[model samples]
Target: MIRIVIVDDEVFVRAGFSALLSLADDIEVVGQAGDGAEALSVVRQTVPDVVLMDVNMAPRNGLEATLQIVKLPEAPRVLIMTSASPDNTAWQAFATGAHGFMHKAATPAQIIGAIRMVAVGGTATTPEVMKRLIDENNLRNPRHVAQARSRIDLLSGRHRDIILLVGRGYPNARIARELSMSENTVKSYVSRALEKLGVDNRTQAALLVRDSGLLDETLANESRVL
Candidate 1:
């Protein structure tokens, strides 16, 4: 079963999500927390596969929690839930290392699918949110962008190709098909690339690729290959 921990300041929201998720045969609600601090404790104890967290919380918010959570050894996937529309806060959360983002108004199906997606090493956010994240971040960091590009340049051509595809938000299966490699090979490449890049997950790698303006070059190369 896919183990999940629910973190929300609201008791009803926590209970409601737990009850809803319990209906899924493949998912188990392993723990719950009212804020980021409590969430950290619960996460360490449960070692869940996924964490559904509210973006806004007292004492310690989800973004702060996520920043710490993703650094945990073998961290669980964090999906940030928000009642607000995608904005600067959402971008901050993503940049801070959240694996996914979902509006509180999401349908049950969307919530379930997002959890599953992030659990399997995939990101989950709406296209609009992603676009905003890229656009806003692009305007903020030229020096860091240069540094990211320099680090990425150290990788082998194949590793760079895989990472660029990852930045484009393609999953391992699609990346495998595009690169003419097996899915397992794609996963291996991704893992090694993350190590070389010194990032914890695909989202951070993707951000680096985007901030460095490599996504455009990567796409052009991919078009020629296709």
Candidate 2:
């Protein structure tokens, strides 16, 4: 079973998540905390497989708490929950070692799925937050050579080519046509790439490729660069 901890300042929010997670056969709510300090204490004691953390809270904020938690010897993976707004502060959360981020308005199933994915060592990012991160990176560092090198090392030459095409927003059918492979083969490659990258979904994988500077290299070279 995937052991979990729910952390939120509001009593109802914590109870709701705990209740929902308790119903999942594969998941167990090991503990709950209403603040960052309590969250740290609970996680250290329980060593749960995953943590559902609220970003806004009194005392130590979620980002700082996440950094502390991730440094634990056998740390639980953290999924930051935030409201939907430009002021939500997701990028900082991600940079601080959050394995995933989800809007508070997400359905219970989505919340559960995000926790499960993170427990299995996968990263998750919403599409809008991902685009913002990519755009920010592009603006701050126009030359992404170092980032490109890291992404290339993550895959075989053929797989890297496939990832670049996917990052360019190509549909699987179009990717298959361009690469002279069947659609099923294209899907297989994308799935494998997602697994290798430790991301929960294709959109996150594509965003990773883009943020790693591989996409920039491909554009500059006028070919599938990495």
- Which candidate leads the pack in TM-score? 1
Provide TM-scores for the models.
Answer: 0.86, 0.67
Question: Clash totals for all models, in order?
Answer: 0, 0
Cα misplacement distance, residue 43 of candidate 2 (Å):
0.5
Model 2 lowest lDDT segment of ten: 140-149
Model 2 residue runs over 4 Å out of place are 84-88, 143-211, 215-226
Taking the tens digit of each residue's C-alpha lDDT, what string does model 1 give over 1-226?
8999999999999999998898789999999999999999999999999999998898999999999999999799899999887777776777888878988888898889889888877789876676787678658577887888898897888999899888876789889999899999999999999999998888889878887888866667779999
Q: Rate the local accuracy (lDDT) of all candidates.
A: 0.88, 0.77
Question: What TM-score does candidate 2 get on C-alpha atoms?
Answer: 0.67
For model 1, name the residue pairs that clash: none
